[model samples]
Structure formats: C-alpha cells, structure tokens
Target: MPTDAHPAAPRPAVDHDVLIVGGGHNGLTAAAYLARTGKRVLLLERDDHLGGAAVSAEAFEGVDARLSRYSYLVSLLPQRIVDDLGLDVRLVRRRFSSYTPDPRDPSRGLLVDGEADAASARDAFARVGAEGDAEAWQAFYAETARVAERLFPTLTEPLPTRAEARSLIADEHAWDAFVERPLGETIDARFADDLVRGVVATDGLIGTFTDLDDPSLDANRCFLYHVIGGGTGDWDVPVGGMGAVSGELARVAREAGAVLRTDAEVVAIDGDSGEVRWREGGVDRTARAHVVLAGVAPVVLDRLVAAAAGTASGATEPSAGAAASVAPRDEPAAGAHSDEVPLDAGARHRLARAGMPEGAQVKVNLLLTRLPRLADASVAPEQAFAGTFHINELETQLDAAYRRAAAGDLPDPLPCEIYCHTLSDRTILGTGLAESEAQTLTVFGLHVPDRLVDAHGNDELRERLRDAVLASLDSVLAEPIADVIAMDAAGRPCIEVKTTRDLEHALNMPGGNIFHGTLSWPWLEPGAEAATPADRWGVATAHPRVLMCGSGAVRGGAVSGIGGHNAAMAVLEEELP
Candidate 1:
C-alpha cells in the first residue's frame, strides 16, 4: 500500500487492459468493478492515498482517526453497487442524530423526524401544522415511502431506455406529471409552517447547487425513494465513515484482480484504440488494454485526450454538457471560461472561491474529552445513536457567513456539522489506542476558502478560522467542548477540493464536475442519460477499447462502483463473455 513519493514524468504508453487514472472513490470504484470482473486494470492517483475525498488522515498527535477531513454523510448511494462491491467489509453506513435548535424553544424544532418518537413525534410534527398537519405529513411520507419502495428495483437495473421506460412504468409513479417541481413547492403544497417544512425539505436538497426553489429539486427528492434504512434511518454514513466505503471498494477491487498505483500522477495520456499510455513510478510506461476506463472527471478525460490528440485550446466551459442539454447558443456564458490553472486557481477561480485563504480551508476535528452536550434535552440525555447533527442557520444567515469568509475575515457565527461516531461503536476511536474517553464531534467546515495559500505557506488565516469554529461551538453551549479536548484540529488546506475537483485534477477532466455530462433531473434517471447512452464522455465514444468509469462516466459521485462496473460490463459484454 506504499504510495509513490515523486511524480511521474511526461510519459508514453504504459500497457494496461483498462488504464484508469485517479484513485479517488469513483476511480477506485471503477477499478474494483473492473478488477473483480477479471479485467486487467491499473489505477493511478496523484494523492498518496486511495480514498480521495473519502480519505482518513492522522492529523494532530494521538488524534482519533475518522474519514475524509472534508467529506462526510451518505446513504444516498445506490444499494445495487453496495451489495455488488461487498462494501459491507468497511462500509459502516450509519445515519447520525440530527437536531435543529429553535433558540426560543429548544425542544420544539430540535429533532429530525425519523429519530423522533413516532407517536409523540407525530404529535410534535403536527405542531408545525395548523390543527391537523401532523397526520398530513405522516400520510405524505407513507405515500412517498410506498413509491420509494416500488422504485427500488430500478436502481440496479441498468440505465433506462425509452422502450425500457415504457415497459417499466407499471403503475409505479415516483415521477409523474409534476417531475420538474421544486421540493419547496411540494413542501408548500403539503404543509404550511416554516419550521416543520424546512426540516423535512432539508432531505430533498442535500447536494447540488440548486436552491430549494429550483425546479429540478423534486427529482432530487425522488432519489431518496431508492434508499433503504440499513436498520438505522433514512440518512446514515456507510459504517465506519466515507473511508470505509471506498476502502471496502478498494478491497473488493484488489480481491477481484485490479492492480492499483497511488501517487501516480498521470502527466499525460497518449494513444487512442486498443492501447493505453501512462507514466508511473516516475518512469514512462505503456499500458495496453482493449478499453481504457476513467474514474476521474470528464474534464480530466477532455484534457488527457485533448493533450494526447493535441488541441489548440485546453479547456471548455464548465458544465458544458448541462448547458448543452438546455439549448445551443453561439457565445459562452459569462465566466464559463477556462485555461491551464497553474498551481492554485486563477483570479476568476479565486473569485469563485470568494474570500478564502489561498489554498486554505477551515477544517476542525474535535476529539472531545467527552461527548458534545447539546443544550436540548432531547439529544442530550438519551444521545441514542451516532449520527450527524447539522448546525444549519437560516439560508440567509448561512449565505452571509460565506460572504464574510469571502471577505477574508472569519464569520462571527461559523456553520458546522457535528458527527458522532462513538454513539454507534462505543469503542470507536479507542479501539487500538486505549483511551479513557472518545471524541464524538467531527465537523465539516467551509469557513476557510481555497484562496488563502500564501507564497511562504503561512497559516495565520487557518488559525483564525479554527478559532472561529471553536468560538461557534462554545457559543452553542455554555461549557466549552474544547475543555474536554484530547485531540487537536483535523482538516488542513490543500489543492484538493471536492470529489468533483478530485476527478478533474486526477484525470485531466475539463471542469471536474461529476455526473458525467448533464446534471438535469432527466439525466440521472434510467431513461435519458444512463450509462449505456451514446453521448457520454469517454465511456461510449473515446475508443472501442476505452471505457469511461469515473464520476463523470456512470454510477457517479458517491462510493458506488457503478462507473467501473458498467465499464467492465461494457468491455466484458463485448469482448470477454
């Protein structure tokens, strides 16, 4: 599992069956799927580790270990890939306990629905309603749950074809005439109260830039219909953490038959059909494969392939496919431009990052001398399950916090998410390293932006960001959780952004935007932009031998190894069996 210390030089063809670039979740998943299916796959990652965003770094001496310092939360993953990849080995999918405090009446709006007691919870939820709203909400869930149940079989059944859709639409009406409706609109129609509706609607709009008011949000909600509670609840982390999920995928892929190389930064990708070119171990090597599968972003492929073919221009508009899906326009959208982003992001990109320190992000891991004591008794006394608690301010407040960070000064009130890993496994971080207490607080922070990296690698801004986080935590409760700190801060600033950025940088993708091409509601489902479609990035078009398997390919974003699995199936179905 040792990773390369140096970068691979400019290279030629390094032979491989399916040469995969990048070792993040998508790349790893694709590698595992291919390897498991008996395809000769070689995975290269720039980072020393394999998890990508699902990484678990040991920062601060004697710090309790956990998944990616930045990325957390899951259960939105497709179940088909979970069982297929045998992720149960490391996938500890557990939903954390969620609480939203109403400073006025702490108990009223604190608990997330599923964690609430059904009878009393229903009564409490009804409080958000006018008179008879509680039963209405429950009835709505029951109805949606049934549709969600019926939608299960389609998740693993390959991308939807037009014919397939016609045959499959057998009374299962998850998406009806109101497909493009926003979840907010649906919430408005379903309930009246602001607090009640906000808590429930949070589930529908977790990922995606689309505000709750965005029309495509409804389809986002439909995605939840396919998830089954692994006995926990609707939302849960996969067992250990995000690392476990990707680690499990790595195990499955390695066990199947894939060879992985880490820190193998692919300087260039050469050749087209029936062969793959890559550099590894700081030596140029040629890998020959019937198909080349990529698990990074499409932009990575665009760059590698474009560089291989030699292009005058080295970039495309970000989200070109999504923009393309809407309509064809002559001129590009403002700021939808690109070029080689030397080292850190360019000025425009920095503007996009807003007011963060150069290459610095605000990440704080609190290893509590004890568990966090929520002021609310509901979460405090029982502290039943280990789950993620979101410290979400109103949208306006949250936006203002980011605006402040954009201004290069720490926000007065930082937003954070506290995850409890010890609640489920009491001996969580204390397993090997014997310790008296455990740190249940794991925070995902964005108070520090990537615009913070200075020439001399200064960390003055990082310290301030950390202080603001602790201050925020202290503000929540009278007693300082830092008082019980056994571990130090966890996350640090680096070029690695989200998994989307990971895919792009690793694979030379154009924008690093996941979801292959388009991100519309129609694209994610079985019907239009499924895996088997022809308009995909490199999977379907690049080469007869190359299979696209990265986050941009198919079965994307999350830890599901669908991109690799589907690519392997593409090659295997055609060439192997």
Candidate 2:
C-alpha cells in the first residue's frame, strides 16, 4: 500500500537500463513514460503490491469496500495522465448505476438502471426516427461524441501505418461517421429497446472473445463508445485504494530516475550469450541487461525465453528443433530460471500466448457488513452506484455468455460489472476504511472463456465458480447478499488459484490463456504482428539489446497496456530516440 517504488528488497544484478516486468497499469504506464526520459529504469513487482487490478484492499477484517474487481473499471485513463499524475488526489468513488434483470422486464427489476438507462435512451431516440429530450439525447450524445472524438486519437495512437491510417484519413468526418458504424447496426438504428440495444451493444464487444451476436461484436461497441466519453460519463478513479493508481505511478516512477525492486524475486531470467542471467530472492546473479518490461504471461516468456536460450542442457522440448537449437539465428541473448519450469508449459503458455484478453478480466473483492442495497426502487440515493456497477446485461444474456465461451463452458448466464467505493470515497470508504461491521465489494465476473477452474471440478470448480457468481448476485441485490458478508480476495489470490500452475510453470497457457496469444482477428491482420509464428517470439528474437512487454509481447491482448506501452516505446526507440 505504500508505493513510491524501490522497496521490494532482495536485489543484486537482476539488471536493467530498463527491465520492467509487470507492475501492471500497463506496467505503471511504461514506468512513467520510461523513467521520464533519463532511462536507467528497473521496476519489477512480482507483487509486494503496486496496484495490479488498480488495487484497493482489506477484503473483510471488518467489511464494505469495493472498486472494479466486480471486474474493476477504468475508462481510457489519460486525461493528460490525469492532470500529469496527480490522479485527482487519491481517487475513489463507486456507487455506479447499470443493471438489467429481465424475466421479461418485470419492471426491469425496478428500473433506475441509469435513469432507466437515460429514459430508455430517450424513448429509444423518440422511437428511432430520432428527436427527444436534451435535443434527442444531445443528438445521440452528439453522434456518440463523434465516435468518441475520432476514437480517442486512435486509442492512444501508436498503431498507425495504413500509411498511418491513410494520413489520418483525409478531411475527417470523424473517420467517416465513426469508424464505419455496424456496431449492432449502429445500436439497432438508434434504439428503442432490447435494453437500449443491449447497452449500445455491450461496449462494442468488450475485450474480445466476441459474442453479442458476433460480427467482431461490433468492434466491442466501437470500443465502449470510447469509454462513453469524458465530460464524465464512463469511469475513472484513483485515491487511497487500488493503491492510489499504483501509488501515483510509483511516484512518477521515482521522480523519473526509476529503480523500484520490492520483494524482488527474479529467480532467473538468463537470456545467456547477451546477458541478464538474473536470480534475485535466493541470489546467484549476473547482468548487463536482457531487457524485460514483462507484465508476464506469454507462457512466462516461452519458459523464460527458453531458459534464456539454453546453453547447458535445458530442453524439455521447445521443439521446431528445440526452438532453432535453443535460439541461434545469430544468438540474440537472455537465459536463466531453471530446475525445469513446466506445469502444462505454464497451461501451453496461458493458451498459445498471442495477445489481448483484457487483462484476464476476473476480479472479485468483497468485505461487507451490509450496504449494497439495490433492487432498484428507481434508484436515487445520490443516484446509487455508491460507488459502481458497470455490467451491460441482456443481448440474449450477453450472447449466452459468449455461447458458453465458444464451447468450453462456464457461463450459465453470467456477465457482470460492479463497484463499491465504500459508498462514495470520503478518503477511502467514508473514512474508517471499513474495519468494523464489514465493507468491500468489487465484482467483475465474465467467466465463460477461460473456465476459471474445472479442470474437472477442481476444488468443486472453485466453489462452483464462486457459488455460481453469488447466484448471479441473487439476481440483483434488493435485499439478499446476506447483508454483505465478510472478507474475500480473488485478485491475484496466489496467481488466481484454480491454477497459476506453479506460478505459471512456463508454457501451460492453454486453459490459463492469459493472452500470451489469440485475440485472433487474424492475429490483428494488416502486416500480422512483426515476429513469432516462426519469426521466433520477440526481444529481437532472443535479445538484440532486449525488448518485449508482457501478456507475452506483440500487440497482444487489450488489458490496454499495449504490450508495456509498445515495449517502452520500442525501448525508447532503441535507447534514446
């Protein structure tokens, strides 16, 4: 909880001019934009805490405290790095409004789900031919805020190159009326119902595993209409929980000199011939830098980059002739971390390790003694989100939970979004951060893709997927969450048990599939990601001076870390661009 960086201990030559490796929040926004420009950065964090799910703890030593773990939420976190990292001073506020219980609208369980979703989207835009209040919901929020201001400068720029989106697409119409509409036929031609076209087509298909009747799930609702737009309506929070946005981006990555070690634990990274054969917590070191920026999960870097490109007998088969004879193509570098790391190779490298799973979106936090009170009596005790709930329910119950996740099964109708900023922040849960009758409630339940733990009812399918997601939150909290119980901690609860397969033994990513690969839209087409697929995964295919960011490198997954902010701006354009 006290983070300004540098305190996780047991260090030595775990090396780095820049090493990063998962301190989340896009590895602290690429170590506060690459240690402010000086560059000898180090940042590790296997966890001595630094806001991974944007943190906020004390699950039950008393009760009631919550954040987006109810799949914690953040909407386009930039606002000039939230006013150059002041983060609206320790931000926290959850009482959100978004619900749908549907047994055929039984009074939509009590409507006030966002003012009955903004008066059923202005009587679904005055019955589709548009025109109603706030001038037809301000011309449908001014054409969804011009498709969220030209898709928020290409979702934070970086991926340019269709000749840079065709020279930023000639005289813009906002890229021809919002990136080529379609999103469930532009919300069923401006809604009327189907619950406001299933909440504007469920944020254009959230972090892809696609299903709101699929067609690339209407680009996940044009990427949640660009976090629903900032004059305030989407979400953002920082303040005293979720470790104050990783303690102010680790105090802007230690006032930009950067070196935070904290509970160290490198164990061994060894990319060999080029350097970085680290070993921290137990000792045995060696450095010169093998470039890391990890945020982990690409099958723990193909078994720590094939045990740092194996020099002395380490092949329990990477095969393809032992990954080109333990990486030779001109010996790039990296090595260490052995005593054979396998557990399904860490689940087949969390399932093939390609990229983007929306940071595995499964967080649950609850510490309660009572105070969720929401069966929807038309909602207004300060518009009740006290502090948050973002679930976009019903589009055939979230496309039958992604058609039971394309067939692996784990969704008996479950798709959630919630928040509890201890009933409106007041310096962390209305002061007394809930330590006596209980407080903490955060649930972001989306299961049906990675089957959270049923390798065969393992520990009774992890408590039958946490009592079938608290019996689907007893179908909307008007009274029975048994007055908010006490203590529960799923966030990183030991690599999220059910299996971290020996803290991700190595390539066992199959059922773990934490996006070492596969957001599969033809692996993001157009030049199809630079390397791997035979180009031999990145960091210059072993180590050119090293560069590879987590969720297993390459535009991988959409936890929106952009593979450690585009591998720390391509290692600051190869050392000082």
In terms of TM-score, the best-performing candidate is: 1
Name the Cα RMSD for model 1.
Answer: 8.8
Tens-digit per-residue lDDT, 1-577, candidate 1: 3338766654344455677777777777677766776777778776777877666555455455553454555644666667777677434544324555543344434454454656766665544233356666666666555544544344344555434543444433334422445665666677765545544554543323234565555335433432322212255544565667778778887888888887676644543544445656677765555456666555445455545554413332222222221101122223445565433444434333321112223445555556556555545523422554545443444446557756755556765556665555443354643255555456644334333333112355545556666766665554665666664434332111232233334434333332434332212444334344323322463444445665555334444455555555566556542
Q: How well does each candidate superpose onto the true structure, as a TM-score?
A: 0.73, 0.31
Instruction: Name model 2 segments beyond 4 Å from true.
Output: 1-20, 23-51, 54-107, 110-186, 189-194, 198-200, 205-262, 265-286, 289-293, 296-366, 370-416, 419-440, 443-524, 528-547, 558-577
Clashes of each: 51, 95
Q: After superposition, how far is residue 394 of candidate 2 from its true place, in Å?
A: 12
- Report lDDT (Cα) of residue 253, candidate 1: 78
lDDT of 2 by residue, 472-508 (tens): 6766656666455543343222112122221123222
Model 2 has an lDDT value of 0.48
For model 2, state the Cα shift of residue 393 in Å: 9.2
For each candidate, the alpha-carbon lDDT, in order, equals 0.50, 0.48
Error of 2 at 378 (Å): 13
